[model samples]
Target: SQELEQSPQSLIVQEGKNLTINCTSSKTLYGLYWYKQKYGEGLIFLMMLQKGGEEKSHEKITAKLDEKKQQSSLHITASQPSHAGIYLCGADMSPNDMRFGAGTRLTVKP
Candidate 1:
């Protein structure tokens, strides 16, 4: 929304490829989150970065928050057809305020 911004609003990857998406904020982030979803489905939490310079990985996915707490990145390795979907990045500016990106649409070519 207003507090968060994401880049490269969309991406396309070939099967077995790797890709990265970035999110940025103007204010310091209290918490940063990554999510994945398919059409007609709910969001699935991928990872959360609470501290600056923090990073986490699960399976072929990895997330990182910059030391400034103003940026975050999500990386996917060896993407498959199942990886094709929408990716979202969220920022919690305060306990009462949370904003999400418009979402990056990812399409994986067979």
Candidate 2:
């Protein structure tokens, strides 16, 4: 597809539930960046992985870049409503050149 594809464009989960979102691409991702955007807010950096097989975590969310550089995943453990937002995975070809997935909107139910 030569484009980034995100799974579960929208999701609803219980406050304490665990969930995972996936991102895949047709091109080799030189780098992968994860960002979160709350409703009506700008994107907030979550993490970035320039090396394959790299995994990073912020609070309750953990993201991993597969060795293939063709896929990545974000895992949320013991989610809270505060965690609800749009999760975006962008593929970076260079420092300022990045392409984003449509995003996965996560809704954590109270």
lDDT of 2 at 34: 91
Error of 2 at 94 (Å): 5.3
Error of 1 at 55 (Å): 0.6
Per residue, candidate 2 scores C-alpha lDDT tens digits across 2-73 of 389999899999999999999998777899989999867899999988888999998899999999888999
lDDT per residue as tens, model 1, 60-107: 999999999999999999999898899999989898889998889999
Full-model lDDT, candidate 1: 0.91
For all candidates, what are the clash counts?
A: 0, 0
For this target, which candidate reaches the highest TM-score against the unseen true structure? 1
Report the CA-based lDDT of candidate 2 relative to the real structure: 0.91
Q: Highest lDDT: which candidate?
A: 2
